[model samples]
Target: MKSLVLCTFLLISLAGCAQNNKKEMNQNYSTEEQEVINVTDHLTELMIAKDLKGLNNLLDKDFTLTHITGYLQPKAEWLKEIETESMKYYSFKPVNRKIEINENKAEVIQQNILDARIWGTRNHWHLQQIFQLEKRNDDWVILSSVASIF
Candidate 1:
């Protein structure tokens, strides 16, 4: 029947459109995910370079960094460490990195081994870090972070 033939054509067309839409969505997600990763990478670079102003611009006002030793370092204290070179990071190797983005908020979970000098001691530590970020005025800013040693 002509009606059946037309219905089949319509269904096929709709399926193709659906597949295209899905592919576009996946591409969009990939782009957004890469943006999040870039932000995180830039933050790390700022820390490594002891760029206080850059870090300040990227960190939210209420930012907090919870250390593996159960001590909470507020933004000022963490920046001070970087400025004084007391907590110097030499290198980091990210083992497992996962990111989740929900609308204007994102969370990045990373498992990494870092070589750093904390206070006066130098060591390589395997750490799990969770970072929370929010889009503020079209720019992603880090809101908080928690790190645990493994």
Candidate 2:
């Protein structure tokens, strides 16, 4: 009977320790996710503000942007389009967003409803955008953006 009691106590103690450890690990993971989200927010803000310099700084040189219309844009082309006002977005509101982190890489999925005027044509575009970010030297930068039209 004593041995059984001791075994039960030990099991209960170990279970409590495991639960505490899991909670701590979850908190740490949440913090890491927040960091990735912060970088993603900055990228979105820069895009909405049309901050060319900020976008340039946050986007990798070899970054690629793929549109829902089956068009692919390289870094230079996207930058030029933004700089020359060829692609203009009056407002971009994300309806839903999710972030996933794996080691040094993060994936951001954003569902946005944008009121944009592209080449003098007013349009409401609902887009599901996936952005990949790579942490380079502790700084997260956008590596790719792929979108789907809905």
Candidate 3:
């Protein structure tokens, strides 16, 4: 009678709410993935521009950087190396860049070639770099990276 009708109505309302919540959850995940990819791409652009300040802002304090030459350096050490050498002497050009985002994590793969003029001598090297990024506090930051000589 009246009780049965009320119970049915309540069940239908609850079911609709659950469906809406599930849709919202999916949208949130998609948005997070897009954010991670966009941030990583921005990082590469910063690198090409040699924007140290931008780089600092995007990188986490505990960031780990690994080179194609098997050298692993902490954040401070990496910044110091660039500072001592002068970033003007070299340029990093990344080509064939690709990004993949999943959940709160992202991976950026790119082929890079360095053009350096030091002591009036030119040095060049090809590189394949993979950047692993994580989302923290709604911002994407690089967690770790590894590169290989190409």
Candidate 3 clashing pairs, residues 3+ apart or interchain: none
Q: Alpha carbon lDDT of residue 2, candidate 1?
A: 100
Looking at model 2, report the run of 10 residues with the lowest lDDT sum: 21-30
Pairs that collide, model 1: none
Cα TM-score per model = 0.77, 0.74, 0.62
lDDT of 2 by residue, 1-150 (tens): 999999999999999987776455335447767677667667767766889899999999999999877689998888787777777767765566778888999998877787766556668888888999999898888899998975
User: TM-score of model 3 relative to the true fold?
Assistant: 0.62
By lDDT, the best candidate is 1
Candidate 1 per-residue lDDT, tens place, 1-150, comes to 999999999999999987776456335447778788778778877877878999999999889999998899999989999989989988876566788999999999977788889889898989888999998787899999899986
Runs in model 2 lying further than 4 Å from the true structure: 1-29
Give the alpha carbon lDDT tens digit for every residue of 20-88 in model 3: 764563354455665665576576577656677887888888887887657897877776655555433
Candidate 3 local distance difference test against the native: 0.69
Q: TM-score order of candidates, best first? A: 1, 2, 3
RMSD of 2: 13.4
